[model samples]
Target chain A: MHLLEIQNLTKIYEGKKVLDDIDLHLKKGTTLGLIGPTGCGKTTLLRIIDLLDLPSSGKIFFDGIDITASNVKDMDIRRRIGMVFQKPIVFKGTVYDNIRYGLKVRGKNEDSYETEIFKLLDSLGLAGYEERDASTLSGGETQRIALARVLITEPDLLLLDEPTANLDPLSTEKIEKLIAELSKKKHTTIIMATHNLIQGQKLSDQIAILNKKIFQMGTPEEVFLKPAHKFVAEFVGVRNVKKGTATQLEPDLTLIKLRKINIYSISHLEGLVYASIRPEDITLSKMKVISSALNEFKGNVKGIVDNGGLIEIEVDVGEDFTVHMTRKSFLDMELTVGSEVWLQFKASAVNVFECEC
Target chain B: MSEIINAFFQAINLIVSLDPEVIEITLRTMFISLSSTFFAALIAIPLASLIHFNKFRGKRSVMNVIQTLYSLPTVLVGLLVFLLISKSGPLGNLSLLFTPGGMILGQTILVIPTVIGFSIIGLRGVKEEIKELALSLGASNLQTVTTIMGEAKYALLGAIILGFGRAISEVGVALMIGGNIRGYTRVITTTMSLETQKGNVELSIALGIILLSIALIVNLILNQVQER
Candidate 1:
């Protein structure tokens, strides 16, 4: 049975629609990663699910009961869920005081959770921090403290909103590891809103890409590798995207015209379409010596940017194309701006999707 | 200059020796002003909560009027309270006129607006996110407000202290409403005004020093709570 269901949820702030027609469902003990760009109503949806805020119009069913029904008090339902905000919230007191707040609100005495608190704190690497002022802690420490407080409650449903967006890399890893462990439990259903693609793929049983509404939702590979929406394709880091007309002249091949140049892709799409190719999928060489790649372009290097691990080169054939290659390969090829180079990619590398705009 | 210097020493002597009249008047001042502040808070806090928690038609206008009342002249409130409690006035049958009870009532009326105004600001100082955080943690409506009040405790305390400072430092209400009866209704500010008019500088100086000291202590405590 679905543990949570939301139907046609909408939120408007001063008549500006923030979330429109949002529908979602999650099975029990499954982790759903909600990925979206900033200001995409991810936080708003989580807030509504946690019962912190009401949607402008929607029906929510939790545990198969209509929780959003008029005159229904959701305080009892809210207590069964835990939410950690993007920015850590520390009360005015010691670390122990901060961690004990959730239990305190639920009428649990401090003595009841003392042993459990210490064990949880020690596991989260906050040992001996019981007396330290929580407000004085670093961003990472405070975030961990926030997570610890929520985790100690043993909520059946956990809603995390970009829990590590502000932390350093090491702190981010610590938080991610803890979340990974929680996902492993398969007893606490988790819905974590984040823009980090790898974290979403690694920790989620399902991935839902959202921009005000769910654009696509499926297993990790289906959402990341075979996105059904153009926005999802572009957001998942497809750097070279161009609008073109697609024509099918072969049994399983698509030819797209990019103004002065044409490329081939292995997709069955027609009419006005947006085609995207990943920067890493294209290979660059001084001469045309491709083996099996169906699409080949000869263009001048418009610009070169030294990305830390790789070199990002923008090539201008009729349309601009971005290609990323290792620095060693770039150096060995002696590539520079204004240099003529040939790039090749398999026909399958191009992702073509029909769109109205 | 020599008289002023002598009065300064005499003021210190009176405070250190705990002069009977000075002690009596100071104690009465504390009693009346503290009672006034307590009564005002009882009304102002709930009023502030109503103004803050509700979406009313004229909320902004109501807040604007309350803020404007913060600067209401002490003498004006004194006259208003005096009329309401005087023999020919509506509450005249209660016989509260010319009594410390009347002074407390006057001061309470005088400071209600200020207490309400400052309490609103104090409550507003609590970040909107904190309230959401409290509710997110499963706090009920009343519990969420308790959390917000806890977070704004210092600012709320400061507001109350500000109300008390206004009460203890105003003479018009005490003099007009209490009648400054020598043994019954004489409080710090009214007695100071009388003694100063009579050219007894030292007694006035002693009372002024005590009043300033109370203000300083309130401020020191405020600074402590407000420290990061």
Candidate 2:
């Protein structure tokens, strides 16, 4: 069942449309990842969901109840939907009091949640720091406590906005693990906004790529493998694409022409199109003698950028193209800038999208 | 020159010896100032919090009026309270003129605006993120206000100290409204005025010393609280 649904959500700030007709639905006990660039209204959407900001024109239903209407009380809805902000805000009190603040406000101050609170702290790796002053905790520790504080209220849905954006890599990993563990054990529905694509892919069951609008939404693998829009493809880091036309066709292959180069299409797509290939899909060779590959291009290396384990080589084969190869393969080819080499990728690995005919 | 030195040494001796007359005036001053500051805080802190948290029409005008009141002279407040409590006045039936209650009323009017001004400044200084966090956590409006006040407790304390400092050191209201009646409405400032006019430098200097010491203690306490 859908636990939360937002329809036609719109917010205008001082004549500018910050959020424009956004619609989203979340199933119970599932995590939805919202990935977008800065100022793309990710935070604004989350704030609207939490009822921190009223939408200009929209309807929101939580468990089939309309929450956007003026008659509905915010306190009742907020008790069941918890939100964690990007920056951890611990009040001027002890850690325990900060966590207990929500419970106390709800009239459950002495309801014997000590065990559960401690369990949450332990899971977030914050045990034994309960009595410490909240102001003195480190950034990561404060974030963990903030999360624990919200979770102790046992809200059915959790809205997190860039929860790990300010943390170190080690802290990021810990927070990621904690989020996963909470969702698994408690079956809590979670909606999170983050800029880290890899982390979003790892944690989300469904990914929503939001630009100025809902560019695409689907399972992460589906969206990454076959983005529905140009923006999504570019956002997801599918870099090597060239504008070309379908020049030849067959049951298994289709040929396309770049400036003076002929390239084979991997998919059975026709007409004027943009053909894209993941950099990692292409292999580099010193000479033009490939075995079972359907397409090969002899080109001069334009540039080489070493990125730790993998080196990305930009080659100018009549039209520009990029190929991804490991440091081992690059060393074996002895490739350098201006080196002439053959780039090889099977036709089955290329993705093609139609441009205007 | 001789008068100043004699008054200074005699004032010190009175303070060190804890003279009964000096102690009586000091205690009266403390009581009046503390009561006035307490009353002002009770009225101003919540007013400031309301202005800080809620948006209303005419809020700017209301704030402007408060700021104007903040600078209203103590003598004007004294005159206003004196007229209200004097015989043949609106509150003449209460017969509160020439009493400590009259002095307290005048000082309260004098200090209330200071409390409001400082409280507004303190609560406004609280970060916006803190308010957002509280609101997001489902805190009611009252809870949010209390949380803001708690976060800005030091600044609010400074406001209270400022009010107390102003009320205790003010002479016009205490002398005009309380009438500086000996063993009755005689506070430090009013008694200092009366003793200086009577050429009793020792008592005037004693009262001055007491006032200075109280101001020093209040300021020191405010500094310590802010440091923490």
Pick the TM-score winner: 2
Per-model C-alpha lDDT, please?
A: 0.88, 0.86
Clashes of each: 0, 1
Poorest 10 consecutive residues by lDDT, candidate 2 chain B: B135-144
Which residue pairs show collisions in model 2? Answer: A266-A347
Model 2 chain A worst lDDT window (10 residues): A348-357
Candidate 1: stretches off by over 4 Å? A12-17, A52-57, A239-357, B1-4, B86-90, B197-201, B226-228
Tens digits of lDDT, candidate 2, A1-357: 799998988899889998888888889998989999998899999898888898999899999989998899888888898899988889988999899888877778545999988888888888898899999999988888889889888889999999898898877888899889778988889998998899889999899998756778889998898776667788999887777887557786889876688788756777787788888888778887837887788889999998897888899888777888888878888988999988888887777777744
State residue B207's C-alpha deviation in candidate 1, in Å: 3.0
For residues B35-131, write the lDDT of model 1, one tens digit per residue: 9999999999888877876789988999999999988898898899888988899999889989989999999998999989988998998888888
